[model samples]
Target chain A: MVPSEAKKYLSKEQFIHQAFSYLEKGVEPTVKTLWLNDEIQEKITEILEHSYPKLRLRYWQHDDQTVWFLDEIGKERPISFGISVKSQRINLVKVLEFRESRGGEIHMQAFTEQFDQIKLTDDNKLNKHIDGITGATMSVSAMKKIARVALMLDKEVR
Target chain B: MKFKLALVSAALLACGTVNAAEPTNQELLDLIKSQQKEIENLKKSVEEADEKAEASVEAAEKTMSNAADSKLSFGGYGELHYNNIEDKESIDFHRFVTFMGYEFNEDIRFFSELEVEHSLSGDGKPGEVELEQAYVEIDVTDATSIKSGLFLVPVGILNETHEPPTFYGVERNPVEKNIIPSTWWEAGAGVTTELAAGITADFAIHSGLEVPNDGGVYDFNIRSGRQKVAKANADSFAYTARIKYTAIPGLELAASIQHQTDLTQGVLNADANLYTAHAIYNVDGFGIRALYAGWDVDSEQAELAGQDKQDGFFVEPSYRFNDEFGVFARYSEWDNVAGNSIDTEMEQTNVGFNYWPHQNVVFKFDLERRDGAQDGDGFNLGVGYQF
Candidate 1:
């Protein structure tokens, strides 16, 4: 079951509110949707072993230069995470919701701030090194994926 | 002739001034139209570029998301134990285990554990290799799931999350090992659900125990009845149900019951009932855990051998000086022949300290005393880790 405190963090409205709080002008950005093609969907199926869910990614673009990527990734269970990118640099990567019985420490700033200023490499991996949290390996891995994808997406848009 | 030439020059100068003074309305309108067309072209190019960029980003994110979802995960734990009884001493590589899992999707997955005990397994060897747990879990919703395969019975706290580094002491509590019969898994299928906030319920039907009716070495030793899912007797089945509450931070209360219609797998007219209850509370580096478990057997043959009822309980309190060090003391008592008229109670007291240099690694030392028909004292030391 979703924790009581975590419910407040899971809604799309809450994600948009938090995303705006991180922007300089506090401008309410409009949602932009992107649908996934077959190649990308197949790769995800291979990774997850099961068929991938709808690839319609809902994000917010600010001034056509910054993008906010919000989604849930599975770590024993699906944990909501958000990343904000500007000019190909990760401005923020935060765990918005955590449902696991343990490993809530992945939400702490000490762990989340490591993704700041990190960029993706040409091979579509994080350029900066990230240290794993003991007992929270899966959560840490999920966060890493968010940061890389957000940065890659930011590069493409710019 | 001079006057006529001056008049013509004046007329020509006047005409040139009139022409240069201003453009007509048509000329101004033509200029504005050309600029508007240039602006429109610029706007259209910008719009097209934005669309292309958005599509490209969308493709990149889709690929990355898939890669993230399909990753495989690995982890495990191991321990080495040393024991000193009276003046005799011995050391054993107790257990090593590995955990592997794969996420089929957000709602389905596979998990397994492989273990080696006593450090070796072969013909005429004291050690053995085993599969501790292998199961597939399907999530029906955010709060409920179904699991099947050789999974641990949801009876005791340690049975499901028994990695050494996750708990205290050099060995598991005796009450859990012998009476509750933990580290116990059977071929089973079950549904687990979060019944309410901080409350969870589970039920399973599995292969049942086949206790020996002759009452020899394996008579009432509930530990020996474990079938380990290897050619397990299927003449009868066991049903288990458990409920746990953890609404209060740092506190947990749980109860479990199991019923086997025939402990001898129908070979003898016997049935068994097992019940267990436990509570654990921790706050501000101080903690306490208490548990009670019992088994009742209904069989003339079992009663004749004085192996009808068995029970045990233990209480442990501990204090952690810091993240790196902690100490605890535990008292436990049990009677495997509670049906007998004789005094068959056995008791034990243990005190131990654990030092963890890292969250996943621990060094342990403990002293224990036993009181019963066969009395003994011992010292134990061990090191354990998980990743």
Candidate 2:
């Protein structure tokens, strides 16, 4: 993994294009798209137990690191996760934002740290363990599913 | 002051003593020594400054992180029901519940559930206000946790997770409600350990139940023995243990056993033991559920009264057409007095449908047929929500 990779999208808001800055100060990140065809959509449905919200997903890449800003429902509200993949493994995972009334414990560093350096296996399963919180089972499950999605997407980009 | 003067005088003598622009060895030594001392002081000062900066950064990070992680979250669910049975009809606000949770840090948390049953509580009223669950859970490690306070016993599928929309039927299933006793809790301390894969085990010791003897109260009913962790007699205690496997996606299997030293609280030398097991499997919107629970009361009077051995089992097969609609049929049979031949067993069949306008809100309707001890036909309609 390259520790000193040039980061064009410095903050999470900038990475997800949620922040507005001086137009001359920053160039728009070069975005790429992955369309959810029947085959890929089926695989994603198997991973998430639900369909993707849109037909295509937009992501950003810098050197060997790629970023995915994804959303999944936790109980009744959607939770957004910012996942970074480097060299086909998880480089970082963070809760960019949360809308659920409960299950905020999933954003704790002790819990999110478990995803670092993890990758998908031959059968497309996580190679590491993700522990579930006492009252945040659904939220934890959502995070795991998003992690797998990011890894799979990384493989496609590669 | 002498050192500074000697250094200045050495410099002046060195300039006059340098006939060929070269200073004496002693002058050079004094100059280098003084310069070296000045460099050491700068290095020391920089080191201290760096330490202070790092400490300040650490404090800022800790504050921001804790503000994000230590949260107080609230959620709740409520249900209203209408049931008509054998020409008798009743419409009631069944339950109003509130849940509160506070995360003290990454390792400690507090949770509580408060409920109002039948929607009212007062003198000569048929409702009650109860604290069904309250506990503080401390993480001993990433894989293990210990909790203490009043908590629902980890015995059956619904006892620990019984939001109205999460389950089928208007009322709780009879087997869990009558035999294992749904919504049962006690003040106790327990440890939960998660092992490899998705396996978990729990063990706890808590207050026991006290069933009045025949002369004072009915002995055949096990559901009436609940003390609800109120200010009551605690001459003896109960121990419970459970283990579950959930490694396989969309599947869960679990079993629990509880032993009570005495259920009569020294009233009849009576004690009762309970055993329960359940399985749930779901795939592609199709699901099935099965459970069995039994009780063994060790008292001569309990046996003579034909209520020593009480047990039941139920199976339900359900299919979800989509996220918003589902249907199911269940068969349940239970007997509170099975110690001897008494023909008191009750068998029932229920068919139900649940409609979810939103994931957290649901509308439910079901029809039931009761045979064996009681013969009747009834149907229930309800609406429930959780947020």
Most accurate candidate by TM-score: 1
Q: Global lDDT of each model?
A: 0.74, 0.79
Q: Output the chain A TM-score of model 2.
A: 0.81
List model 1 lDDT by residue over B278-361, tens digit each: 888776678788989999998887787677889989999998776589899999998888888998888888899999886568
Off by over 4 Å in 1: A1-9, A15-78, A81-158, B1-68
Q: Candidate 1, after superposition: displacement of residue A100 in Å? A: 5.0
Please give each candidate's TM-score.
0.70, 0.67
Q: List the residue pairs that clash in candidate 2.
A: none
Candidate 2 structure quality by residue, lDDT tens digits, A44-112: 887887666655677877666677888776654467788888789997888766544335556666677
Compared with the true structure, model 1 gives a TM-score of 0.70
Top lDDT prediction, candidate number: 2
lDDT of 2 by residue, B1-387 (tens): 999999999999888877756778999999999999999999999999999976876576466344323367677889999998887899998999998777665567777889999988999998999999888887776567788999889898888878887788888899998888888999989988767445788999999887767664566477888899889688889999999876654567899999988888877777778999999877666788899999999988889878789999999999887768999999999998888786988999999999998656899999999999989999999999887
lDDT at residue B178 of model 2 (Cα atoms): 88
| lDDT by residue for model 1 (A18-67), tens | 65675667557767765556765454443333443555666687764455
Q: Indicate the worst ten consecutive residues by lDDT in candidate 1 chain A.
A: A1-10
